[model samples]
Target: MKTNLYSSIIEKISSDKFSSIFILVDENTEQFCLKLFIKKTGIKSFNKIIIDSGEENKNIDTCVSIWDQLNSFKADRKSLLINLGGGVLTDIGGFAASTYLRGIKFINIPTTLLGMVDAAHGGKTGIDFKLLKNQIGVFNDPLEVLLDNDYLKTLSKEEFINGYAEVVKHSLLTDKPDLTFNSLVKLDLFNDSEYIINSYSLVKNEIVKSDKYESSIRKVLNLGHTIGHAVESYSHISDEIIDLKHGQAIVIGIINELYISHKKFNFPLRDVVSVKKHLKKYFTLIPLKENDMENIYDLMVYDKKNEGSKINFVLLKEIGKPVIDQIVDKELFKESFVFYNE
Candidate 1:
């Protein structure tokens, strides 16, 4: 919950005593975030490591490269790593830092809206394994998270929309009437950044505090992620990579899961339709062929939320009211795709 920006972060880091300081960025952040970071802070005394920017790069090979760089730089147990990028950078950088020499102190400077609202705040540090999403990771908190809206100024509309999906997901999880479907559809991120970020963070942090290990209440945060991750992984491993972003996949997942909610939990059909209609305005519907469903289902079975053969879902009983650990049959899962297509 402790967030600062720009010079304040530089001052904080400058005052801290550590064996060494390292800044982890992707190719994009190196140009967009790190350069501005150095200029604004007037501090240039850190080792710089850059990786490729994409979900495909979120893997063990990236971790190995990072660990090698840290070792080459003689980063000891007391080294401090500053992750300055979007979700991929924070996730992989945190994972590398956590596992390197047991553990090291780190800070998150999330450049993307999604990173600011969700990925950077959560203590879930991870990387994908074997084309699965977040298949390998550990729970490790950062020294601090520095969120600056300035970083979002340079984002492409696609990137902005990608992050906005999490905002919508968070809004749906809250009872606040101000975050209604109409309000969400009309949201202007530049004007509403402060309210959106703080509100979503508050909800997420409270849920995480109650269940740090994702044993119960925390599962609510995974509302769109179960099917979302499956779709994401499918896009990644498909014969032709479907150019789908994480949030886009999640929006699709939310709509499909909303259908399940309508059928299984008697959630209002009208509400489900309303949510889907609003989301479609911002996200393109990715074509998922019939053959793709089985592959997506196979990926879902490997989800960390599942146990044995049953795939556990966090379905909505109503907007802002989620019922967790609900198991749906495979037949229903296939049918949900049909519902999505219709």
Candidate 2:
């Protein structure tokens, strides 16, 4: 476990001084990463709540189920809930804990790379609605986060690669950008637990600077997600499954929208091509059908960031300099997909 995770969690717990501790885990976390908790902390007597895992299980019903479980445990504001799993567990569990008794202290012990780097750091909590991703959620920070790279050993290649996308994106947008998309796409570091954990923590600390609230600087984190989430939602409905991992979907989204940046914002085309080459090595270019584009485009309109019909995308003027609020043209949006498929 990284020192930052323990320190962050302890700082919050000490500040809050909750009366009871409630830890949340799904079936998978219990199997893979439970012992880490036992070794690190003296918290042997915490209330445990288990829920189903996976994207499909992320819903209001799941939140309700957690709420009911919290009630059963007689959880109060003085109690702290520690979400100990992947994004699904944290998102849904955080929401349950937050809503219960009008918000309680919650900590995130993210086991998956996805959770540690991206999902765990952010205070955003919610579940999907109507097959839409994170359609219902709130922006609230956890008391602290616990990140252990050892947990990633159980991840499949696809899952590891999926989580790697965010790391690549973070690198691309940051000053050092030391971790190239090529190295990550290779997925060779799957065995290097320390490297995996440190990489995620570096990115987390970068994006989660003083702007932990996500009002200004943090919106840059949505660089790929604005379009990726929409594409992922459409893929979920397709019969073929689209074979798109979360990272793969974001890679495509970034590429397609990078094209938008190139044309609209005059972003460098060479940088985009370099990134595409690196990403395409790991992610097969999925051909979006005409209807797939339409459905995904429609979904983008419903994005929470939108103030009106215009979709605001965080586009890069260059590789590291990202600018937001540039409303993407729908016709041009369609054309970018064409370029992507080509």
Candidate 3:
């Protein structure tokens, strides 16, 4: 399906003429995106389903609630669900829509930068199970994905930075030298929204088209996610009141994984330093205690990409070159954190 196209989304929805429409949003998007969507698109009749915002809410329980709402509203197969929010809202809403009545038409209106660049385009729809990220999901593409940069203006600096992490990942994966950290920092999402979003979407779409099921080349997209998901889950499960946002945790993952690349693949240390320096501008290091490392490692073992006891990683051989399914020793995994600390 075509992505990041605003006009096409409106055209498609108008043409579909569905029996009913439903909009799923969190508390955040209800305030920001839904209003603008209503005003701009002149779509006034959809039922509104607002959930609480945050990673904690992306779960089976939330899906059940959304399902109950759809049932109560008597939404049919012809109904269209428009998911409007950040990653959390899109993930859960997509899962809910895909499952309801054996599947209903759905669209994604990504309100956050992260959602626009990463979560909205991918056909992967999922919710976290037992605090592991995307443990339960289906490969279901939305009928259309609408990206409007105006929604990004409502995001706080931290939320914007969270999305920027995925952009950095996209840059690292592609051969785009112009998409460097320095250039990204100066980018005005409002003015350059089409170029940036479409560029990232093109990279992801090309990769996904090759490995739709993530068996081989697609695993390269999981570059920072192995350790990143663990760190994110650890924060959620830990007693710490402050949870790490997905992009914040990912930046940490990117740094330590780059260190692992340096140790295992002899990737250039200078490049690692350059990446770390650029990332540190947006995120502070999350100090991992020995116990935290133990917990995080435990979480990594449950990664969906693993086979039996072996923990597979996608480490970079060089900038823009990712080697997937590399198994790192446990001791080196532990030592990588030490390198990150330094």
Candidate 4:
């Protein structure tokens, strides 16, 4: 925590506004980020609520465990819960803080690259349900979001790539970036972590300011998620398929959706190919059985974004120009996946 960043967060902690404060962490964050945070902020006393790491642990069961911890520790509504990990930590921590004793104040100190750029802000706290992504969740803003690029140094390459996917998405969504999408994707995340993360945070925050509940403009944020989430869900259930990071799956969704965009909206074919070629270099390819289209299709049809039988997608007329609420049939989806595999 830098001096300027610490001023506001420390103000909240030092103030008598809360009866007590609690810090939340998963195993990875506890080992890597906890002490650094404690020493940096100089908070002498607070409760720790530790839990298992990974998306598999992000569910009602975990939420119950968190609630149990808070109850045992005597956390009150006034207590501030500081979630100090990646998306999984913030997702469940925000949910726990929101529901326990009918909502307590919470702050997010996102650790991973993905967490900083996408998961930490936006007030979307959630857990996966019924093998689907973000099926059960709430929209509750945190008291504050603290950012520090120091945490990016602790991430593994795979973890960094998980967030870089969103970086690519945000860059594509905007027409005027300081760096072009090609230059942006090719740059090393660690070398440019501060600028990249700040750019993404600004883009998401700007969009979220207009549509807090994702009614209109915010839907543009889901450009890759419609098909991406379905693939992520499919990976979760399949024994043969390795689990995909949220961003990796989203990258797949972006590539395939670009295919759909070119076919339906005539978004330049060369742009689509170039994006697919570039992103694939960063992410490991997800293996799907040749006959797995129906399985993935079923998952897509069940996507929360879909209405009735038709699946809604956010396609691009061009980079930074998203067309939302476009309904497409299953056959086109199958073709998009085919394009992705190539």
Q: What is the C-alpha lDDT of each candidate?
A: 0.85, 0.78, 0.84, 0.87
Candidate 1 to truth, TM: 0.94
Pairs of residues at least 3 apart in sequence or in different chains that clash in candidate 2? none
172-256 per-residue lDDT for model 3 (tens digits): 7876677644456567755776678877777787889899888899998898989998889888889852589999889888888
So what's the TM-score on candidate 2?
A: 0.89
State the displacement of the C-alpha of residue 118, model 1, in Å, after optimal TM-score superposition.
Answer: 0.8
Global Cα RMSD, each model: 2.2, 2.9, 2.6, 1.4
* Descending-lDDT candidate ranking: 4, 1, 3, 2
For residues 234-259, write the lDDT of model 2, one tens digit per residue.
78887855546577789878988888
| Model 1 regions more than 4 Å off | 1-8, 180-183
Most accurate candidate by TM-score: 4
Flag regions of model 4 displaced more than 4 Å: 179-183
In the predicted model 3, the residue pairs found to clash are none
What TM-score against the true fold does each predicted structure earn? 0.94, 0.89, 0.93, 0.97
Native-to-model Cα distance after best TM-score fit, residue 161 in candidate 3, in Å: 0.6
Tens digit of per-residue lDDT, candidate 1, span 135-212: 899999998887777788887878987887788778778776776444666666768887787777777777788899
Candidate closer to the true structure by lDDT (higher is better), 2 or 3? 3
What's model 3's overall lDDT? 0.84
